[model samples]
Target: MASSTSLTLSQALLARATSLHQSSTDRVSLATFTGLKSSSTTTTTTPLLSSSRRAANRRCAALPGPARTRPGAVKAVSVETAVGQAADTALVEKSINTIRFLAIDAVEKANSGHPGLPMGCAPMGHVLYDEVMRYNPKNPYWFNRDRFVLSAGHGCMLQYALLHLAGYDSVQEEDLKSFRQWGSRTPGHPENFETPGVEVTTGPLGQGIANAVGLALAEKHLAARYNKPDNEIVDHYTYVILGDGCQMEGISNEACSLAGHWGLGKLIAFYDDNHISIDGDTEIAFTESVDKRFEGLGWHVIWVKNGNTGYDEIRAAIKEAKAVTDKPTLIKVTTTIGFGSPNKANSYSVHGSALGAKEVDATRKNLGWPFEPFHVPEDVKKHWSRHAPKGSALEAEWNAKFAEYEKKYKEEAAELKSIITGELPVGWEKALPTYTPESPADATRNLSQQCLNALAKVLPGFLGGSADLASSNMTLLKMFGDFQKDTPEERNVRFGVREHGMGAICNGIALHSPGGLIPYCATFFVFTDYMRAAIRISALSEAGVIYVMTHDSIGLGEDGPTHQPIEHIASFRAMPNILMLRPADGNETAGAYKVAVLNRKRPSILALSRQKLKQLPGTSIEGVEKGGYIISDNSSGNKPDVILIGTGSELEIAAQAAEELRKEGKAVRVVSFISWELFDEQSDAYKESVLPAAVSARVSIEAGSTFGWEKIIGSKGKAIGIDRFGASAPAGRIYKEYGLTAEAVIAAAKELS
Candidate 1:
């Protein structure tokens, strides 16, 4: 069979259903949930199909063309089909309510989770999981599977309920019962690491939708690079469910603008227009025309007037979204916050808090669901049971197609296989360049560009760009073109001036293939404040994104206090599972890249310099692996009288200070503390060998805040660093004025020793 994208939604559904139904020995239904149109509104429902009519339809479907339709067939078949659709609608309604009730019961059990979004968005969730998306429930990491991100992550119960129905072992019935409890797979918010089916960790509003944009970008890039006319292997859509809160966030607009500019056709977003927030109606703080704004941003916009029971309308919107192959589509689904609750529906009280016991009972009765809590009716369960086997068959069919494609296109298959399986090419690290003391001095930022270009040549997954600071950050890949709407095969991603979106989008790209896509983003070091939330998520979600931060200190000079990063380095050092590397020169810069590439489970931030620095003696890529290593030593047995430590541009100053102290016949040692986090991970023996605890005369020099230096420097030792903001002057002038110099380091060292 060909790729599913080649067929219309209805055709694909019918074909798969007929094929599966015919192959089964027992009664297996892969039937579509159809409904009758309502006279007053788009929301509608029909009764369950009668057994006889369903069997007749199945028999007719399995037969040849002439036997399937007889004389006067068009009118008769239409009438019968309409009747069957009307009957099947009841089953659809039950399935949708199953999702809503599961969410309600879970929230009521926890009494601390959000239930309104799940209750209101059940129809949307049900249609997507049961009908639209293609996936293998047993293999959540299937490369070709559609990615779904819930930007409104507080309503994660909707996803957990759907996952349970769709046969994901990660979200079983017990997991649902344990929602919001510690150690449960179902957390209060969606976390990709904790939950297998979740694509990315989402909690802060707008991040998930931005991540969806990156996911779509990855798909488009891979498809353009690997898909042949006859064999389209890399094909998938990225779907997101965002709410009013996500829209209110500026990060969402930043990412959505790029999504529209890039024309990510396979990105379809469902805007949950419930009009209710935690503080009551959205009218208090939001009243903008979201649909019109999306259209202005170049997105194809559709509005579903009623999302409560508009099952067919939701499906149709997805179909239309898939039809548009240029720009991303946004379906604004208007819904009641709590659709079935008698008193709380559409109210702020239901937005977060659980419906009390009385209200839960009232909701159950209001929806005509007479079953007990957490109960899934046999009929609804039976209808959804087909998805598991169908999903397995879909995956198996794709595997067979891939095996055939591999035979004909061996080279392309090998490359794509590495991306799919996350296997790196052998000896890829040899691509990183090494420098010697004789080499000309250059900014670590400039040196970083060399490492980036070299890595791009060897690592197929290596790709990134700057946040409109490509020149200043030195992050452009010289061999590749920009990854534009038409030129997606190129590696360089132009994220424009969107710093927060750039960081979050890279998180999505890094998390897309799990260790396969190494995405790095760049901006000025101080600008990290703009994207700190996304960066924190990167660390929390274990998205190994390389953050190329230039202008590491007061070194950028004339840009003044606002551009300088006095406390940024110290702040990131406080964050866990993040490598904060301040590479001094060429060798150290290469080493930082090595660490970033090797540590696929932890993000690495390389704080590089704007000013040129000498490629000092004894600085090596091997030494950088140790995180903190002795670059030079004139003393014996690691017992120097005065040990001076530094990182990035300040390392050069410490080395100068060590040379002067040694000339005075003082036992001096210079250490390059490139990465404090990595150094902390070292064995105590290695750390002792580098910074012996007995040496109390330790003095450190850096151009940033001295807040955390006390950990490495003894209480008696002095740290030479600027605690105040930088001034707008020449770098050398600012260095002297701020006491970030060799003289300052030497003076501090003498005072300690």
Candidate 2:
């Protein structure tokens, strides 16, 4: 049956070629060949030269018709002719070889990089960079530029090569030479901060693919919100190149499935089917048919017989993929690893290590190339350089359209301009909801919800959603619409159950959104482990994404230790550019939101309590902004004998304990330390004034671990916190059982005194 099918496909291709080649204007009638083959066949007739002009055509015409030959033999000859013709691209052929050579030279220069991908998948990357992608080399952050992600980030050489050839400012010759070195624009992986053309930081196997989904999501949302009936302003596609390693990683599956569910038509992934992995052939572990799996996930799947020699086919497939308006497309392009390399082709040896001087010379000779190191033919460089202006022209056109849009819709235009500039709306924090001391006790999450609602009313750019816990996480803004699959105007997002994807997507949205939109994502604090890498990237890139995490500690009842967060606070605090704020009450929660919105240079995580607490008199917005402050004064005045410091729900306990200690004749001061990271950033005079060094005796109270608190509490001080995991019970009961009461704080304070 396979043989018969092949013969029939060959005959159909020959017939289509005859019809297309004879037609002028390079346009052919695709409908005339209908029913000549199976519907799966994407056969289109295009003009080809006479049989005398091509050796392959003469050979093909001389062969006997399909009916007179063995089926397998007929199919093989026809496929060879078709592949030969597909590979014959004056523009793309030279560009593909350039990509491969540049990749080889760059990696050889760096002495560290995975070279197999750049050499093997050069055709795919070449087609994408030269003909398929749309972006501005002059302005890498062009809001409507197509996003390209290298999901198999070990193949950074491939992306760097394309960026250099395409003329992005981030990848100069010096940067290429300095690859993997400290402070170089070209890092080992595609880091957005390090490279201009890079959309997200990707080195971990599966992150880039998931980040692409986020970028696609952002495009859809912006298109929905801003595009007019005539002005399709916010439309752009996201393209990703993935390999065996990316598919094997679980995060890829998680993101791909979610993208399929959302039916993101703007997302197109090209899977490089090289078969070889770092250890050897992929059959050692990954054996599933990747194309079928993606099809099962509701993606439009296309298979290219030979990616290395089928540049036109890959290009055609990508064009056809763009027409798929209902679902994202995944094209599996079968490629030989280290193509054109005589000694290392199809082997794992070429995956990481440099091809060595001798082998490199041999590979160049095999490909009929010159021997000079880092050599590039002038003609080839000129061919790729033609694409440089295409992106700039595209951006210029978009800018003209934007100018017209601004005239018609001034407010929306200004809003979008603010987002583009990464600026917050003026006086955006003035509307932050404030709570008085007499206000009723409420969970911090509820306070957060109120804050979100207030901000959403005043700040149209505040967009986010919770990870399948919107109701519980209290991340929803009633004033704004929900960002559903089709509803782009919705400000609030419903990320469903995909936590990792949500976090990465939030990063993309935050990075790509015009300066004003503060993109955020939420989930239980314990589940942040799933999205830690993405969160770290947001911090590293300084994307300013707010992470709202609830169910902060053992105070979360009955869900047990699995749901409770023990090390989450400390873990987040350790991240370099992230601000971790655990607010104590409603007012402080409002303050945290205010700070998060105003912060443009750093990302923030607002840790909120699931349980309600009294609106304390000391929980002032001004005091919270200082990161930490003396909320209560000592009765003895001149200097406190002991200082009680605490955060979140424990602050109330510390305040109560300080009152008790003062009554017992020990001068006591209570400090509301909302953010340890922020407190540490304050000047020594400010920190000493808040917690005077004269008062060496100090008691630090919190619900979590005491790992990093010693630095703040000092040698003579102690921390009153749960050193173990939490249990499943009522929050009040758990707090008492864990000795988190005011009595425990007072005892610790006395001991320190």
Q: Best candidate, TM-score-wise?
A: 1
**Model 1 worst lDDT window (10 residues):** 50-59
RMSD of 2: 12.5
* Model 2 lDDT, full chain set: 0.74
Q: How displaced is residue 325 in candidate 1, in Å?
A: 0.6
Worst 10 residues of 2 by lDDT: 50-59
| Per-model RMSD to reference | 10.7, 12.5
Per-candidate count of clashing residue pairs (backbone under 3 Å)? 2, 11
For residues 1-753, write the lDDT of model 1, one tens digit per residue.
Answer: 433332222233333322322322122223221221112213123221110110112111111111122121111111221211222778988998899999999999998889889988988898888877887666566567889999999999999999999987677789899999987878999987677778899989999999999999999999998899999988888999999999999999999999999999999999997778888778788878787688879898766655776666576667667667899988887677778888887788988899999999888887889998899999998888877776666655566567667778988877776666566799988899989999999999999999999999988888999999999999999999999999999999999999999999999998887667899999999999999999999998888899999999998999899999999999999998899999999999999999999887789999999999999899988888889999999999788998999988988999999889988999999999998988888999999998899999999888999999999997888988889888899999998887788888888888888
Give model 2's TM-score versus the native structure: 0.87
Q: Kindly provide the TM-score of model 1 when superposed on the true structure, using C-alpha atoms.
A: 0.89
